[model samples]
Target: MQDNLPIRKIIHVDMDAFYASVEQMDNPELKGKPIAVGGGGARGVVSAASYEARKFGVRSALSGAQARRNCPELIFVKPRFDRYHEISKQIRAIFYDYTDLVEPLSLDEAYLDVTQNKKGNPSASLIAKEIRERIFKEVGLTASAGISINKFVAKVASDYNKPNGQKTVNPEEVLAFLEALDIRKFYGVGKVTTEKMYQLGIFTGKDLKQKSLEYLDTNFGKSGRFYYYIVRGIHTSEVRPKRTRKSLAAERTFNENLSSEIFMLEKLEHIAQEVSRRLTKSKVSGKTITLKIKYSDFTLQTRSKTLPYFISDKSIILETAKDLLFQEKLQNSVRLLGISLSNLNTEKTKKKLEEKKAVSVQLQFEF
Candidate 1:
């Protein structure tokens, strides 16, 4: 561990099968059955699956048709975003009682810095335990937690004993715990990166630790440095309370594929209106507008334009999408149409950028 880096207590809390659990909780009939929360039609995708369904190899992002094939008895429940948001607020309220340093990753999980909590509890492990108990009692939901010196380990440890369990990696044991972990289990290392690591004979944290910083950078570019330090228990990223919104988008999948641009103009107008409304609600505008098209053959394409000035008006957005739509002929019938706005006005503050720079410099020391 680097002497200049701060040693703090961090806990990552994740809800177990959140959407599926909520469906089962609200309707007792689904409690012990295999259920999926999403449409079960041909083009439908499973947003979440109950644990019972998971035993049959059913999981999120699996197509509805494949999910049904995996578990014939699976019941499909439509997602209730409003209800989930309500429950999420209740869970966050519980977190505020313990600490103000809460960084929510999604509706299901968050990271909390409890070094100096409202309860004056010095033990992060104990605080995590209390938080989990409170969630079960007040919200009637099960949550798992991991306590460690930094966010990276805490995020990974939270998954060690899942569903309804917790793990604490003390400062002294952090090194051994990470070294034994599978490379695939590390956060931010996705499937493609895992395959690349395998090609380089990096299968475990111990194997990764054997490589030099220069060697990692040569192979993995900027991420190589991250792999070098993270394997040594030196992640210094603080738990940020307010994460910025990088982009906003809205899209729709049609019931029937449209063959001509004339058929898509109406759809683009509606999509542009939705995106405009969202931008207004967030009190932000964007200089970049993107139109995403998905063909019936499953191929996808995007066209974007960056204006000199920011815009949030529906008319301007619709005009921009129309121009992109006519930029090229239709290669195939369209199955999905989407409009997204980026280069948002709410960019990161100078303080955040400086903090990131400082973190980069701090991690440059030899292990």
Candidate 2:
């Protein structure tokens, strides 16, 4: 642990194959069977897969056809978002019984700051155990957890013992635990970043720590500094109870590819209206507008423009989207179109600025 930073007890709870688990729970016939939640068509993708399917190398984001090829007995079930949300609410209610400082990452996972919890239990490990037990007993579903001194470490630890298990990284073991971990195991390091890290000879956390901050910055830009600090156990992100919205978007996938620009323009107008309605409902406006285009070949491209002022009006959004659409030529027939607004007028952005400034100041006094 860094000398200047105070220790915090954070717990990350992730449900076991949440979407597929819900389907199995509702239908006894699906229990112990390989199942996937999504359409089984040429354009369909898997949202979630049961453990049985995962054993056959079937996973989320895989094409439905590929999933079936991987597991010939894979059962396809349509997703029931409303039912999932209902169960998620019940699980959150259980979390509140122990700590009000719950920050949900998604419907299936959350981080709880148990340093000062309602339970007043000194052991975060015990609290995590009790919470998981209650969730399983009440909801008839299992969850995994990772308890540590910060959000990043806790999040990574939660995956160590998955499918109804937990792992706690004590303060004394923090440095060693990180040093031995595979570079791919780091929370924010995805496939592309992992390949980049491998090319840089960074195979483990220890290898990453040996690189100078400047070297990382030169290679990974803003994210380089993030990797430098996180490897040294210096992540300071807090569990925000009400996580602010960063962006809002609306998109549509056509039943058939549209080749004409005029047809695409008409589709963009409706997407802009949906984005405008969403912004108004959230009572927030944004200065940045982005147009997303997906070709029939499944290639994606985006164009963005930032205005001097925020806007929530459909007319402005449509005009901006139209300008972007015309700015580029159609590379192939269009299969999907989307519009999004960012740089939102929210407290999260302001808080991030303040946090960045504080970190800069702290760096001068620390290593």
Candidate 3:
């Protein structure tokens, strides 16, 4: 049904091994080493792995023990989230310079709806190139970018060439590109779905496009239509930030490491005030409070506690953050601290959905 909808120009930018790359960039010493960030312990999972590590059968979510077995000299560095966040902000600023239609997927990935842009660059490929160059020059890291007429194809194109790579599927080439792709390469198709498609003799975009719409709908429900359209290089949904926040977070880095409990509590009071204000503005109350901490050596960790009911009071936020901070074994002086709230009330979310629907309808009428 959405295939009949208007077309949109989209770009997907995915930073290659973001955490590991940041580590490599900051300390040239780590550049060529098989590097991984997160989970040095036997049971912990890897959050990111460098291209060097990826060559040795290492990847994000692999257990540290297994990764060690694969590459004995794998360098494990604790994440420096504050610095990473700063880089993310810098990169995102570059996106906004071209188009306000930026949708942040995470600290390292985003979708840009550059149907209309500040630079008036008619080709999305050129935009992706400029953005990648800006990220490299400004952030001291490299990223891969993909451009297409729609999100699904653009997401796939971005991964086609990786680590300082960029790929573009122009309007004329959309159908040909999708037709040649393996069904598994589709953004939403996972291993399980690919297996199913294989059993059904669906291997390529042409195979998927040949399936009757009714049959697809009966088999895959709402997602069937989505699959049917994307296989033919069609996705009408515009690039958008998922504004629904189950969590809100803000953190601060102090010029000097905190050594005194009294001073820590005073700083938390200010953070709590800011977090509470954000919660109030969103009209959302959270049942969970998360405290993020970074030590002097750049080691980072998080502590979270959930309340029985949602809360948005400054005093409650301050008390919870303080409690979590004190509970931690403070072996090192804290250099940065942050408080976040999550698991918001559903009633407010329902209202937001209703408002979003009205806005969508209004936009349709205006168009």
By TM-score, who's the top model here?
Answer: 1
Give the 10-residue window scoring lowest on summed lDDT in candidate 3: 1-10
lDDT of each: 0.94, 0.94, 0.87
Ranking by lDDT: 1, 2, 3
User: Which residue runs does candidate 3 get wrong by more than 4 Å?
Assistant: 1-5, 247-284, 287-309, 312-367
- The 10 consecutive residues of candidate 1 with the worst lDDT sum are 345-354
* Per-residue C-alpha lDDT of model 2 across residues 1-367, encoded as one tens digit per residue: 5888989999999999999999999999999999999877767789999999999999998988899889999999999999999999999999999888999999999999999989789999999999999999999999999999999999999999998999999988999999999999999999999999999999999999999999999999999999999999999999999988989999987767999889888888899999999999888899999999999999999999999998999999999999999897889998889999999977777678699999999999997
Model 1 gets an lDDT of 0.94
Give the poorly placed runs of model 2, Cα more than 4 Å off: 265-270, 306-319, 346-367
lDDT over C-alpha atoms for residue 106 of model 2:
95
Global Cα lDDT for candidate 3: 0.87
What order do you get sorting by TM-score, best first?
Answer: 1, 2, 3
Model 1 segments more than 4 A misplaced = 347-367
